[model samples]
Structure formats: C-alpha cells, structure tokens
Target chain A: MPFSLLNLKALMPEIFLVIVASVMVLLDRAVREKAFFFWMALVGTVVAWLLARESLDLHFGASYLSDHYGFFFKTIFLLVLFLTILISPGYAKREGFHFGEYYGLLFFAVCGMMLMASGTDLLVIYLGLELMSLSIYVLVAMAAGDPRSIEGSLKYFLLGSLASAFLVMGLAVLYGKTGKIVLSELAGWLTSDKAVLTGILFFIVAFGFKVAMVPFHMWAPDAYEGAPTPVTAFMSVAAKAAGFAALGRIFLLAFYPAYAYWVKLLIPFAVLTMFVGNILAVVQTNIKRMLAYSSVAHAGYILLGIVSGTKEGLSASMLYLLIYAFMNIGAFATVVLMQREGRVGESIFDYQGLAKLYPVPAFLMLLFMFSLTGIPPTAGFIGKFYLFRSVVHAGYPIIAILAVLASVIAAYPYLRIVMLMYMREPEREIKLAPSPYIWLALGLSALGVITIGIYPGSLLTSVLASVF
Target chain B: MEKVLFGYLALAILLSALFAIFSRNVVRSVLWLLVLFLHQSVLFLTLQAEFLAAIQIIVYAGAVLVLFLFVVYLINLREEIRLPKFLGSYPLAFIAVLSMLILAVAGLVGFVPAKTVGSLSPGAILKVGHTQILGEHLFREHILAFEIAGVLLLVAVLGAVVLVRRLREGEL
Candidate 1:
C-alpha cells in the first residue's frame, strides 16, 4: 500500500471542497456580507467541478476509485450543488435562516456525495452516506423556530441513524460471510448460502432506505415539507442520486453473481414504490409533500433501470438521474418563487391563476410540470424514454408497462399544478418573492430540460460511455 | 476454556442488550447498555481483535454511555417511563421481531464462512502488534477515507454550532 501522489491528486476535488468549507466557516465570523460566503461557495463548486474533470480515471488506494463512473456522478452532484446554491439565497433571505454554515454544509454534502460515488469499499461508502445525511439533517432543522422544521429534522435523524445501523449490521454480516468488504473482492464470494443471502438482504434494506423505496419512504415527505425550499430541492435530487450511485456500484458490481436473485427481490418493491408515490401524491395539498411523493415515484422509475441489470439499463438510470436533477429542481425553484411574505407558498392553491398574473414564471412552472410528467420535448420524458427502453431491452416489458402506467398516475398530480395555474381565476392577490438568483436557476434548468429533451444524443452517448 | 469464556461473554451481551431495551427506567437502561458494550468488547477480544475490543470499551462503553447517562439525567425520566411503551402496535412489532429472529437463526445454523482471510491474521497481528497493524492500514491503505472521516467530524461540529447559535439582527 504505497501512498502514491496520484492517489492524493485523485482526491483533489473532495479535498478542495473540505478546504473551501473550512474557509467559509472562518470567514463567516468576520464578514458581515452574506453574499460573500455565497460567492465563495459558488466559486468553490466551479473549481471542484474542474478538478473532478481533470482528475477523472485516477484511483486512490484500493478503497477509493475515481473512474469514469464516479467522475460522471460527481459531475451530477456538483451540478445539483450549484443549482441548490443558486436557488437558496432568495429563500434564505425570505425565510431569515440564511447562515454561512448553510453554504458550507452544502459543500460538505457534495464532498460526501463525491466520496460515495468514488468509494470502493463498504465502510467508506457508509461513512460518506453518514456525512451527507448529517449535513442534511442540520440543514432541515436550520429554521429552528419552525416546529415543522424541528420535527422533520428529528424524524430524519432518528430514522436515518437506524438506517445507518442496518447498513453497519449488513456490512458486518457480509464481512463475516465472505471475509471481504471491498466491492471488487466481494464478487468472489457468490455462493448461494443462506448467510450470504441474509447479508445481501440487509444491504438491500439499507440501500433501499437511502433511495426511499416504498416502505422506506415515510420520512421523505415530512422532511421535504419541513426543510427550506432549496434544501428540499437538493435532497430530492442530490441525496437520492448519491444513494443510487452507491447502490448501483455495490449491487451491480459486488453482487454480480446473485444479480437475478436481488433483481427479483427488488422488482416488487419498485412496483410498489411507483404506485404508492404517485397515488399518494394526487391527494397532497402541500406542494412540497406532493413533489416529495413525486420524487419517490421517480426513484421507483430509476430503480427500474437498475433492476434491469444491464449496461444500457444502468446508463439509463444515470441519464434519468441527471435529467431528474434539472426538472425536479426547476419545479421546486418555482415553488421558491411563489414564496411571498406571510405565505410560504406551500399550498397548491397558491398557484391558482398564477399564469394570469406572472405569465413568465407560470410558463416556466408549466414546462417543469410537463417535464416531470414525462411529456415530450422535456428532459423528464427523454429520461423516462431511455429507462423504459432499457428495461424492455433487458426483457422486462411487464415492468416497463407497469412503470408507464405508474407514470400515467403520476401525471395527474404534476398536471394538476399546471391546470391550477392556467385555468383558475385569481382568488387572492398573488405576490412573488422575486430574486435574480432564482430566475437564473430556473432558466438554466429550463434550458437543460429543453436542450437535452430535443437532442439527447450527446448526453446519452457520454452516459453510455461512462457506464463503468 | 476459551470456548467457555466466549460462551459466557455472548450470553452476557445478549442479556444486557435485552435489559437495555426493556428496562422501564431510563437510567437503568443506560447502565444495561454499559454492560452490553463491555461484554461485546470482551467478545471482540476473544475473536483476536484487541484493537477493536479496546475501541468498543473506550468509545461505546466509556464516552457514549456517559453521554447517554447525561441525557437521561437532563430529561424528565419519570414522565418518560410512565408513557405506554408499545403504543398498541405490540402484536405487529412482535410478529416482525419473531420472523426476523427465526430468519437469523435459520441462516446461522449451517453457516460456514468462505475461507478468504486477509493480511491481518492472528499471527500477523502478533508479529506487528495489533495497534500498529491497524494504524498502518488506516493511514496507508485507507488514507482517503480517513481524511474524509476527519471532514465528517468537522461537519458535525459545524452543524452543532449552526443549530445552537443565536441569530443577530439583519444577519443571515
């Protein structure tokens, strides 16, 4: 185990993030201008993005890998971090919980996500997951005066700790059964033993909790609705993507021989997740809760790609997550825009007659809603198209059909938002908490959605190329 | 003799764990947890993981248990103990626990681990010293994760400060 300089260089992006976060913390005490911290975090993310691009394909010991797959996921995480920061300033100013630590915590979260993406060992991945979850728990509780925020953070923390416990227990069992914790080494112990099966089941439950599959998703909506709008957006995309990245790496690589067994185990959960998320979303009055459920449904759709267990299927999941970051965050950003003083803009009723008053923002919201529902010429549709195609290619047309039906059910809630905006008359005076940063985030998201939707070939090609 | 000692430690660990969970008094639960951690550490020692055994006692039994006792002291323990424990979901919880217990027993009955020993065998640990072996592995083999763990601790500290600090006027 020679400590090579190249291994250190491979970790440059994550190290850079840690440095920036520490600098932000120190600067926060001295600088009165909050925008300074924001600018610093923004610059830090851009630099880390560049570092990640430059350091791709480098390996750090046997425990950490910075291959194409990890690099691509890191790119997604940095994108999510960028969009989250862009959307945060406005909401933080409006809500009065904008601390320097918010930005720092976000950087730390992306750092953790990068670790999860690159970690080659189970222990490293688990630590990375914990880092991400702890930052998010604090972010969720940042608005300490809000009871909902406190409750949400408490629930997320307790349940998340339990999930981590399950993960540790799983790893212990796995280590005992196979005498291995590294993903590359675990493949050798693929015998159909009951102890190994139990270990794999624990891994499934742990990762299932991370990705919010079906029964494990109860914490999502409450946590989402209670957190700050930008934080919620970040959680829906970035956290879930990190989970899927680690889940894909561990299950597809480590458990390759038992692929059929786990895929069979996951299929029912995936179907249940889709139906539960979509059907429950239709009844939600709170906008955040609805999107939370929608995200859960999206998780099921993404899980379809993984359960397919083909290169094409995994790549489609990556593309789906990449596109989901845009459309989902865009939808949440619109909710942020609707945050006028004295009204949190959490209710679907808040959007009634929005198109009549603010046509531009309303149109943006409509585009996002359409994309979320998997309509054509939006990134969400392209994402779903490839996912279902991959599933079909993998000879699971039944699951694909079921997913499409679930998406149809998902459409009702997504489109209902659009319908409320365009058709209903104004019941009250609509006031928007307009900010330049939110507009930038929304515009970038819209641009991504439309560009990738129409001509997804380039992104698709890279996604396929990077399916390590 | 070694087998007998291992058996005693295992039974003690299980009994302490059960008592930790089912104890009505919060303070009593914390004490039971201490016993559980101590027994578990001895069990680790029997497995030839002396470093892990020491850590189990130092971290979990020492620091973590003390923290638990502090928390219990700060809270109104009488009210907490008076609350109905199961909240009417006893049957469902019982079924789930029973099934899981059965599954674990079934799995463990005929389980023989695959023979894939790593470099850190008992002989290797004895030659190099357990702590030295662990230090070399942590610092050289897994340095990236080690540094990341440091960052994780920093984030935890920062989170605690952010959550507890009072806000000033016009400060984000």
Candidate 2:
C-alpha cells in the first residue's frame, strides 16, 4: 500500500493524453492555423501509443492492472484517434468550426477512454465514463450550423445523464451492501450474497446503454446522424471500444460470481438486438442511419462474445472491436471525403453511380463495404469467425447459428451500397478531390482488414495470451 | 437522545432526496439537491469520515451544483423550455418506495438472527482510545486509497477548469 511514482508511471498513456489535450487547447487559441490542431492530435496520439507500449512492461495484478490487454486497447484507441484527426481536418475547414477546441475535446475524450480501459476500481471507471460522456456531448454539438446537431446533443446529454445516474445508483447500492468500491473487493463480497444481483442488473443496464444494445439503443441513430462524420466515427469506434473494455473488466472481475444472472439476461437482448438491427438496416435509405443500425448489430455480436463467458470469449470480443475500428473508420472516412461545400453526402441515392465519376474513391468505399459485410479476406470476416468460434466452443452453438444468420441478413445493405457504386448508371456526375491523408487512412484500414484476415495468428495469439 | 437526533437527520435527508427528484421547477429541484447533499455530509460526519464530509459539501453541494445552477440559468432564456412531466407513474414510484421499505425492514429483521454477538456501541467513538484506533486505520490501512482520492480530486479540479475555460473561450 506504499505510494510510489511507479504507479503513476503505469498511467503514462492517459497522462500524456491529458497533457496533449491541454497543450492543444492552448495552441488552438494561440495559432490560427486549423491544420495544426489536426496534426497535433495525431502526433499526440502516437506519443500516447508509445507511452502505452512502455507501460506494458510493468507488472499486472488484481486491483491494479498494467499489461498486454491495456496496451492493445490503448494502441487501438490511438489508431482510432489518429484516423479521426485525419478525417476531421477537411470537415472542420469546410464547416468553419473552431479546430483547436475540437481536437482538444477529442484528446480529452481519448484520455477518459484510456483511463476507463486501465481503471481497476469501479469509482475510477465511473469517473472515466463521465469524463468521456461530457466531452462527447460538446463534440456532438460542436457543429453550430446544424439544428439536428443541437437536438442530438440535447438528447444524448439527457439520456447519457440518466444512464450515469443509474450507474451511480448501482455503485451506491453495491457500496452500501459491501462497504467496498474496488472491483476485486466487490467480487469477493459477491461470492457470498445473492442480494448484489440487483446492483449487477443496474450496472448491466448502464453499460448496455453506453454500448447501444437493443432496448437501450434508441438514442444512437439520432446521435450518430447528427454529429459530424469524423465525430460519428470516433464515437462509434472509440467510445464503444472503451465501453466494451470496461464491460469486460466488470464481468471478469466484479460480476464473475453473478455470471449466471447476467448470462440469462443478456442472451435475449443479444438475439433481439441482432435481429432488429439487421432488419432495420435493410429498410434504411440514409447512409448514417444504416450504419447506426449496423453498429447495433455489431454490438450484439460483441455481446454474443461476452455471453460465452470464457477467456477466449473476452479475447475474441477484443479482436472484433479492433477489426470494427478499422472497418467503421474507413467507411466513415470515405463518407467524410464525399462531403462537398459543408454538406455531407449521406443519402444512399447520393452514392449512386459514384464508381463512374470517382473510380478510386468509390473502389475504396467498396473495399470498406465488403469488409463491413464480413467478406472473405477481410478483417470483419475473421473477427466474426473468432467471435462465432468462441461462442460455439463455449457450448452456445445456437447463438453462433443466429449470429451467422444475422450477418448474412445484414450483408444486404452493405452489398447494396457496393452495387450502387459499381453497377448503377450516373444520374449526376460527381468529382472527389482526394486528400492524401484520407487515402492514407483508407489504404491503411483496407490493408489491415485484409492482412489480419489472411493471417490472424499473431494477433490472436497475443490477444489469447493477454486474456489468460 | 443521540438515536432520536440521528433519526431526525435521516428523515430530513430522505425528504430532501424525494423533493429533489419530484420538484416540478428545475430551480426548486436544484435547491432540494443541495439540501440532500448537505444531509449526506452530515451522515458522513456521523460515520466519523470528517474529510469525506468536507469534500461532500464542498465538491458536490458547493462547487458542482453551483455550476449546474449557472448552466440552468444560462439556458433559461431558450423559448418554450419543456418542463418534463412526471406522467401518471406516481403509483409505480410509490410501489418502488414501498418495496424498498419492505426490503429494508426485512434486512433489519434478518440482522437480528446474526446478532447473538454483542453489538458495537455507536457512542464508542467518544472513548479516548477510539481516536487512535480511527487514526491508525486511516493512516496505515487506507493510506493508499486516501492518496488516490486526492489524485482524483486534482483531476476533477483540472476538469472543471477545462470546462469553464472552454465556455469562456466560446463566449469570446
């Protein structure tokens, strides 16, 4: 219980992000150049990544963790942050938004997320959640021109506040029952008591809302559609990844005793979320809304991995989250580039016959779409394969069957987007002046998806090792 | 006498919490929240957590709720502010409260079965040796957690600064 600077050093990645965010905010005010904020965010994230890698060399044990799992997630979060900054510059410039505050808020949010991934105590986790949520509410409303953005911000704030209240209530009840706030201590208490089941249920509801699972997913589409494309990409990937990380930690550490309780509760929600998300996505014409529903389905798949309740299940969920970041960011990056004159091209009709006029951009979009649909030789396919295999291995063959069926049903909208690009005749000629950074993001994501699909041995081995 | 005083304080806390949740006006709700927070600090004091009580009052009631009030006032000028209606769900709320009361009673009853052992006196803190007992526990056992709490408070201060400063910049 001795206080040591070594403990502080273990949190270097989060500390670095906080420092960068502060500096970015100062630089944004001092310098008028917009590109500076973007580059600063990117460089800051890379430095954070290096710091996280360094932290992985430290010892990990109960109550305090520093290890491969945290390192892996920190890297993924940094990569997502880098891509978010890359795609944001053009959108920020076109929209006449204050660039520095945007990146500053982003870095702050990333810091919260990194802390959430690294936090060992329930109190720290709750604080991290609030930190992330507060920053994102501002980011969602950052674009002043859109009335929808304001509405989305209000809705997200209200609903997110409600979720936070539920989480706090759960924590309070758990603390009152056990006189402990650290997850390890709580887990020890849970072994002897069934009364803590109510607290666990409330915690599940809180996390379910954060991840946008079926019954709690009402606010997602509006929020996703209303935010700027880059912000949407960041929220979809980074926010959800952090949520999953926290969820995994809670289940593995605190709620392991009540696994039977949650497992029963989650199965129905997982199936419903998958079925509803896919069915809804099939009817959506708006690109953003479609992606939103797809996100819901992906949440179900992640939940499916959780329901398996094994170390393999947890590792597979992490892999799926990693792959999900690349596919989602690539998809949204293409969408961001398609914006012209501050108007993001969000309609499915707007994408029609894009291949004829903008071959390379359209092709890249096709690659993203294919990857999202879990086509062979893509990270998405491998991600789903690991998730399904884990579930089946855990004796949930029926869940895996439903998951495959849902994925097949979900592929329709993704393929439809690809078909619209490749097969349709042009109604209006479109020209996309590509940015090198955008191309760099897309190419990197595409290459990652394909490379991981072909040989997932190293990543899988590392992920498996981290879990055990 | 102490038991009666503690009972009155607990009742006040419960009433304020109810008022905070059910008040129609946002301003009234915030005021009730402040009262409830103050009562919470008193409870912390009763538990001999003086440091925590101070933080409870300063951070939650004094600083954070003031920010909430400020934001509420700033946004009050918006046209057609929708005051959230508490639908005809009073019955549900009543049922929830009733069930919680029943559960509390049940727990109290259950505690008696395990009470063959003599209970620790609530007034034992007045003993001279009790001060050392409390200090030893705080400094020796809970020291790491205590320091971490300090770090958390520092982070919270920084967060508040960032949020308020950003708002100022927006105004500029």
Candidate 3:
C-alpha cells in the first residue's frame, strides 16, 4: 500500500485520538484525582473534534474515505462521546468506579466508531467493529463491584462476540465466493454468486444483532439496564449509529444492484423489530430498560429507510440517525441527573413529582419523551415524517402505517414517564446530585432536538445531496 | 507421500477433536486438544507452509497449552468437570449437529478449488518464499487491517486491566 501523507492527514482524527487516549492511559495511572483525568478526556475530545472538522474533507485511500457521509456520522459520534463523558463522572463518582480507564476506553471506543464510519473495505469495517465492541465490553464492565454491570457486560460480550463471528463468517464466504474485499468492487462479482448470496444472510443477522433487531435483541435490554448510565447513553446513540452506518454503506454500496432481494429480507425485520421493541417497552418500569427497547424501535424505523433501497430512503435514515443522537443523549442526561447518592436511580417511580423538584431536567425529559414518541415540535416527528414518507414513496404503505402504529404504542411508555414526573405525587424525597457539565449537555441536546425539529430543511437537503 | 501424511494428520485431528469434546477429565481434554493442535501443524507442514506450521506449534501447542494447564491447575478441577452434562439442549444439539454433518459431507463431496490465473501460485510461493509473500500482502494490501489489529490488541489489554481491577479486593 502506498502510505501517503494525504491518507494520514485524512486519518488525523483517529491518529489524534490514539495519541490522546494513550497519553491519558499513562497519565491515568499517575494522576491521583479522577477529576483530573476527566478534564484531560474533555480536552482530548475537543482536540479530536477540531481535527475531525478539518479531516472531513480529506478523502483518499482504497480502504477508507473521508467524505460528507462519514463526516456526518463522525460529528454525531464525537458529540455523543463528549456528552457521555460530561454525564459520566457524576455517576462514576456515585458508584465509586470513577477512574482513568473509563474515559480512555470511552475515547478508544469513539475512535473505533469513527473508523467504522469511514472504512470502505469489509476487513477495515470488521476490524473497526471489533475494536469498538472490545472497548465497550470493558467499559460496560467497568463498575467492578456491581453484579448487574458484570452480568450485562458478560451477556454483551458473549452475544457481541457471536455477532462478530457471524460477520467474519459472512465476509469469509463473500471473499471465498467472489475474491473481493473492498465493498465497492464486490457488487460486480457478487451479483452472480450464489454463495455470496448466502453470505448476505450473515450480514443481515450480524448487523441486526448490532442494531438490536427483534430476534437478536434479547441481550440489549439487560446490557442497557445493567451498564453504567453514561455508557448506556453512549451505546444507545453512537454505538447503534455505528451499526446503521456500516449497514447503510455495505448494503447500499456492495448490494445496491441486488436491492430488491435485500429489501424484501429487511421489511419484515423492520416491522418485527418495531413491534417487539415498542410492545416490550410498555411493561418495563426501569428507565434504562425502557430506553433500550425504545432504541430497538428506533433502529427499526431507521431500517425502514434502508429497506427502501433508494437515495431518498438512505438520506432519510441518515438524517434520522443524527436527530436520534440529540434526543437519546437528552433523555439519558436526565436519567443521570435523577441519580441519588448511591444508586443509578433507574426505576420510573423514582421520577414521581420530579417536576416539583428539578423542574428544568423534568421539562427536558418531557421534551425528549415527546420527541421520542414522534410528537410535533421535537426532532423525532420530522425524522419519522421523512422516513415514513420515503418508505411510502418507495411503495411500502403498509410498513409505514405499521411503523406509525408502533410509534403510537411506543407513546405509552414515554407518556408514562411524563405522567410520573408531572401528575403523580411524590413517592419519596429523591435527592439529586447535580453536575454542571451534565446540565450543559442536556441543555445543548434539548436545543439541538427543538432546532432540528422546527427547521430541518437545510440539514435535510445537505444530507440528501451528499449521500452518494 | 504428501497424501499419506495428510490422511494420517486428518485422522489424528478428528479423533483428538472428538476426545477433546467428550472427555470427562479436564486435563485429559487439554491433552487431547494438544494432539489436535499437533496434527494441524503437521498438516500445514505437509502443505509446504513451514512458517505457519512452526507458528502453530509454538503458539497453540507451546504457549496456549501451558496457559490452559495453568488455568485448569488453579481452578477447582473435579467440581468444574462434574457441574453439568448437556442437559436440555441434547436433542436439539443432536439434530443441528446431524444436519451440519450432512451439509459438510455434501459440501466436501462437491468441493472444487477454483483455479487461479496469474496470482500467487505454488511456484510463486516456492520462488518468493511463503513468509515474504505473506509479509508483502500484510504490509501492502492489508496494512490498514494490520494497524487496526494492533489497536484491537491494545484495547484488549486495557480491557484485561479493567476486568482485573478489583482482583486485589477478592471480588474475582
């Protein structure tokens, strides 16, 4: 491979993150105060973000690209990572698990997600996925003494490793059948190969596992509920977005010629994922578990766009994923704020009379809840509109209607939170440990959600234009 | 001679794999696994892949077996071996295994290696040497993957440290 200066410059964000994370890893051992590492992590993320902003336009190499599509997802990952770090220290402090590895692992996970977004080769994408998955496995298990955390982490590890196995197996089959590695070049050989067609099943199940589609979604809620709150927030947004990013690129680029076949395979999964996620979310009392199921449902909606197999559908999914990062981080930020002295404070009943006490966060949670349920005046509605419109435009009116129904069913859980916060009497006096950084993140997220909800025209046009 | 050696290696591998899975004693299973690894390395040797054969023996037989022996030695052996014996999923496992075995047999029966055209042929490997060819591929076309693997391993090390965090506290 020609190791070009241009390629390294294109990868400046990833390189910057590696250096920063390594420094922090060394500094973490020497630094006595966890707060010091936290500040270092924040500084590193800011520097990485600046590098990422410049790196977006630097495109080359046979394996990876630095185009608008990757750039869009990278920005979302960095924003989510920044917010996750901001919201993390408070909960880590409460859990007595505040340390350097948490932030270092988180940053590395962000790097992995960025790589996944940018990689064009199947090998690069797979390696990126593993790197990200490994970091998250460690981060999920970071709360050592907590059995829930360990259990969640273990479950995630087993299922995640299996998912990776499926992906590798599929990629191997594709390579064996077609002898091509780069996704763009595979389409010509892949269109005529039967074994490569079989390989497509592995890709579906593998990506489905990553995005938590229904049959493969069993591990998600346990992992989500049991993980540390900040990690939960990060995984629900950035990690899920990473899954869709790979899915969109691989299926769109490599399998575009075979779209008709994959679309048929994807439609039922979209419906099942949405229905199961929403219906199961209804009975969940824990906030994290509810969000896990809700995230699954959102993944289903995003898949609705991919299933259409058109640029319009693809653009719609891209736009929805960006909007999702803001709303999810907003909700989880409130969940972080609701934490008491010792616990993560995840039970829905914990939010009773929340409006009377922490009115600002309570109101923000309401906005997030509304956005999540596709109510107007929040970003989720506009996202849902474009996604379903594209699906219907692609001639799948029934799936769109079923999606509308699933969102309607999904409203119950979000509204239930709203009810507990606003209408119900206080079950007990809940003490909140407020972190200023978390508040800033929550404010920014709420602003993002509302601003995009109302004026999505410019962003929508750009997303549509740049997707090719 | 190569065919005869391949036959012996394949038989040894199959038997050892079966014994490794079915053996009740944990140490016995590890010994069977060692046999499987040895046979695999010999198969590679027969294929003229000397580098792979050497690495396979060194890594799998030497280093990995030592680690496995250490873990089996440290843990409660009898209790670990006696805990469970394929309880509920036996029938389902049987069905799945049978179908997969049939599929494997059919696939092998139908297998035909695709003939390469102007690519890395055996003559090319004999001339250029396997290690150099492997290095060229790794450093050239797959360099990005090579670098990413380093990142993956670094993450794993960090992960191991994280997992072992409360080891001093008797949590493990």
Best by TM-score: 1
lDDT of 1 at A325: 92
Model 1 C-alpha lDDT per residue in residues A1-468, reported as the tens digit of each score: 446663578889988998888888888778888999888888889999999988888887788889999998998999989999998887787667776778989988888888999999998999999899999999998766567787789888877888888888778888887888789989987777777778787777787778888888978888998888899999889999999999999989999899878888889999999999999999999999999999999999999888999999999999999999999999999998887654458899989999999999999999999999999988889999999999999999999999999999999998998999999997877888888888999999999999999999998998999988
Chain A TM-score values, per prediction: 0.98, 0.96, 0.97
Candidate DockQ values, in order, are 0.54, 0.16, 0.43
Off by over 4 Å in 2: A1-6, A59-63, A342-344, B1-26, B45-80, B83-172
Q: Give a tens-digit lDDT track for model 2, residues A313-386.
A: 99999999999999999999888888775454788878999998889888888878887888988889899999
Best by lDDT: 1
- The local distance difference test score of model 3 is 0.85
**TM-score (C-alpha, index-matched) for candidate 2:** 0.86
Ranking of candidates on TM-score, top first: 1, 3, 2
Top model number, DockQ: 1
Residue B154, candidate 3: Cα error in Å is: 1.2
Deviating ranges (above 4 Å) for candidate 3: A1-6, A341-344, B1-24, B81-114, B121-123, B166-172
lDDT of 3 by residue, A1-468 (tens): 335543678888998888888887877668887799888888888888888888876754678888888888888898899889889887887676677777888888988998899898999999999989999988888666678888889888988998998899788777766667888888766563455555787799898999999878978998998788899999999999999989999999998878877777788899999999999999999999999999999999999989988899999999999899999999999888887654547899999999998788789999999999999989999999999999999999999899999999999999999999999888787777788998899998999999999999999999998785
- Per model, state how many residue pairs clash: 1, 0, 1
Q: Candidates sorted by DockQ, descending order?
A: 1, 3, 2
Clash pairs, candidate 2, are: none
